[model samples]
Target: MKEYPIMFTAEMVRAILDGRKTQTRRCGDRWAKVRPGDRMWVKETWCWCWKCARLNDPEWYHSHDEDDPSIQLDKCGVKYAADSNNAFETCDPMNPKTRKEEFKWQPSIFMPRWASRITLEVVGNRSERVHDISREDCIAEGCPSQDWYRVNGGPEKWFMVLWCNINGKKPGRSWADNPLVHAIEFKRVKP
Candidate 1:
């Protein structure tokens, strides 16, 4: 099976972790090449412990070598934002901090393959107009059920709002525009 890295937002990561999300839809056929049995490693916000210890200095890597023996592998490992609220590191041998601190969470796009903690196996793929998404598909996309949207509208309305929020500003991608989308159905295969 082919392997690919798929980026996910913190919210989407949470949804997948919580067993609420099993599918994703792109504005176009960007994921068209993905087929059943393909593996997707989720890319989420994360930081290496050594980087976190350096006060999250963005350019810290330029000065230090990751393979340097001085860098403790145990203390300089990868930390995922979805798994913890904070990351702790022993920066000083003399005076170590007792509490954890929030990691300078990197963007999902910047996450490396080694930092990915979740893996998904593609089960299906299809193309359809964005407006054709059903309530079931909405749930698969991590939206609340129709009952949850009863106060405001239907599940479609809720999904429309979410889709617009993510794609409305892009040219020809708004819900009203009804752009064809590539829908990828997957199941979590690894933790």
Candidate 2:
């Protein structure tokens, strides 16, 4: 007789059957949605919503189609909470030695409600700064936000500016700094 390892606890097994685990599935016009009683192949690295597990084909999981907009958004929303080892810490932009090291990190501040229409501007000595400025919009929502990560790269030699609409009528003041690599500038369009 061969012996197999039991990895899932009774509670976890129960949760899976009860549709409590993170997964995604196709529903009507949408590609990913939550559904109950969906069967999922549980693995140490298989992390997803309950719906995704049922709707996602095993072979398609590793393919680029997994990057579908709806799938990405749903996954983004669940990433921090679902990952068992997610953590973050504050860092000093001025001092590198004082920075906290962790596997997962994000900004402590919540994005303003007007964040949907925000724009980013970058002014640097190199072309890379332009790409960096565009990547700033990848900030993940909720805990473990990507704001800090967006601004943490490169040497401590450049300045950055971030502007947004504060009152929905006029452009808010720009936040200028040289914490990372090249100076960046962001300007909000007047509404």
Candidate 3:
């Protein structure tokens, strides 16, 4: 199967890591290339350790020149060093003592497939209006369970917040306007 790189915001990454998100929508030119049966490497901007950076190796990194052929990548594509006892460190911007070997706040688009901890298999895809999102689909999009019970916008409200936050507040870009969106349903692929 063909593999593609997909970018997501930090918040969306958290949702997916929680095992609550299974669907996503892509717009503009990015959606045209994706299809069912294709594998997607989820990319998110974040911090990582030197080892992690070496394993991911997304082009911007070059600090670690050494390579270990024995290390293996998990299904999520993360490679753990042999001596770390399966434990590794991640870059924490909040931490002031961070070392040079750490990678911090890198953009998701630059994330390499090897460093990705998430993979998705597209099971279905369709084009629909942003306003056409249903409550069920909202859940699939990774809305919090509590929002589902809200009497007002409920799940749709959550999605609206995310959409605007990600796509920006540009005119004519909103769910209320029912703009065209490419909806993709996917299942988590074990690493």
Output the number of the TM-score-best candidate.
Answer: 1
Tens digit of per-residue lDDT, candidate 1, span 52-123: 346445476456665464544435456677777434544443334412453446888887666677899999
Per-residue lDDT tens digits for candidate 3, residues 102-162, read 4445677666555677899998889888878898898889887774548656787888888
Better of 1 and 2 by TM-score: 1
For candidate 2, write residues 1-191 as lDDT tens digits. 11111123233333333433221111122212212222222222222332322233456555545335445343312222224432222322244332222123222132122211212121112122222443322221011223544466522112121121111233222233211222212222223
Model 1 misplaced stretches (Cα beyond 4 Å) = 51-77, 83-86, 89-102, 145-147
Each candidate's clash count: 0, 21, 1
**Roughly what TM-score does model 3 have, to 2 decimal places?**
0.71
By lDDT, rank the candidates, best first: 1, 3, 2
Best by lDDT: 1
Q: What lDDT is obtained when candidate 2 is compared to the true structure?
A: 0.26
Report the lDDT of model 1 for residue 57: 55
* Candidate 2 wrong stretches, greater than 4 Å: 1-57, 62-66, 73-119, 123-181, 188-191
Candidate 2 local Cα displacement, residue 102, angstroms: 18
Model 2 residue 119 CA deviation (Å) reads 5.8
List the lowest-lDDT window of 10 residues for candidate 3: 74-83
Q: What is the lDDT of residue 39 in candidate 1?
A: 95
TM-scores, all candidates, are 0.77, 0.20, 0.71
